[model samples]
Target: MRPLEGHHAIVTGGGSGIGAAIARTLAAQGARLTLVGRRAAPIEALAHALHGTAVTADVTDRAQVDAALAHARAANGPVTILINNAGAAESTPFARIDAAGWRRMMAINLDAVFHCTQAALPDLRAASAGRIVTVASTAALKGYAYTAAYAAAKHGVLGLTRSLALELAGTSVTVNAVCPGFTDTAIVAEAAANIARISGRTPDAARAELARFNPQGRLITPEEVAASVLWLCLPDSGSITGQAIAIAGGEVM
Candidate 1:
């Protein structure tokens, strides 16, 4: 039988990129999935393809999160696995960072995790084995130029994950963070395009510049990130909480 055959999962930001990959991976393991995202069309299409549910909610809004959870519960039962994958990143020089940008970063990256986890906590606790996986980033583990706001927000996510892991110790729940670097996603493609515009480099050269951050000199695949998340959700991984597993090809180590 599949490891997650009987579990129900809620994956935030499940419309595309890493979230979409994780949702597909979990579904393959037989977890009943609810793909939650701000945009309904993408997640709805994916959910139909995967035989899962799709919920539209702005994770930063508490009421929206609660409503989404309610809908998910009705469709797939209580959530035994919660993937806090909804987040955004921005690159602005410290001197140029404004209050609006800082707040936006924190709202999506850190605040959303808090809201979603709280909403899902009861369901997670009721399960024999529960998992909460947050998709953070390499910025959470270290510093980066022109990304002070983004880095700070991601760092807060890691801090929250560690604290909750310990707070829920002795329970059936496990909380952890997966941090990937220079991933080959739409976000990275936009960054590469921006680099090309700013530096007059070819698109391929711009992408290579971002990939150079990893010692392997390649972008991390969404499938690779999904694999890590799947491993954490396995029942055998109950003891593996409070970890910031870096999927950055030794870049953070």
Candidate 2:
């Protein structure tokens, strides 16, 4: 039998990149998957491929999240694992970030986490092995240039992970965050574009510049991040809670 044979896993941002990778990994281990994303086409296609259910909803909105989760639970069972992987990052100079920019970052990166965790808390608390793994970034651990708003929001989510872990310590729930650095995702492409615009460098050059942060001279893969997330949801990892597991190649350490 698969390790996650009886688990019900809900993955937000599950249409692509790390979220999709995590969903695939969990489904492989026998967990029922509910792919949640803002885009219907992508999530629906991926869900079809993986034989999972797709529910399109902007996680930053509470009403959308609640309705989405209800649909998910009705399709699958209650959530035993919740992956908070839906987020966005805007790279702008501190002085250029207006109130709208800062609020947008917080709403997507931090507030969405709060809403999802609360919405899934009941089922997670009742599950025999409840796991919540958030896909945070290394920016949460350290500061990033021209990404003050993004970093601040990431740090807030990491703080939430820690606090919620403690609050749920008495229960069967475990909350953790995975911090990935310079991942090879569309977000990284956006960052590279920002760098190219600022430094007047080629996009490839900007990507190389971003990859230099890793001593390995390469960006982390979504599958690498997904593997760690999958491990955290395994039954053996029940004791590993309230931790920020960095998937950076020595960039964080």
Question: After TM-score superposition, what is the CA distance of residue 239 in candidate 1 from its true location, in Å?
Answer: 0.8
Whole-model lDDT per candidate:
0.95, 0.94
Residue 234, model 1: lDDT of 100
Which candidate number would show the highest lDDT if scored against the true structure? 1
TM-score of each: 0.99, 0.98
Error (Å) of candidate 1 at residue 136 is 0.3
| lDDT (Cα, tens digit) per residue for candidate 2, span 1-253 | 9999999999999999899999999999999999999899989999999999999899999999999999999999899999999999998889999999999999999999999999999999999999999999999999988899999999999999999999999988999999999999999999899889988999999999999999899999999999999999998898999999998899855
Clashes of 1: 0
Clashing residue pairs in all predictions, respectively, total 0, 0
| lDDT (tens digit, per residue) of candidate 1 on 1-253 | 9999999999999989999999999999999999999998999999999999999889999999999999999998999999999988888889999999999999999999999999999999999999999999999999999999999999999999999999999899999999999899999998899889989999999999999999999999999999999999999999999999999988954
Model 2 pairs whose backbones collide: none
Model 2, residue 136: what's the lDDT? 96
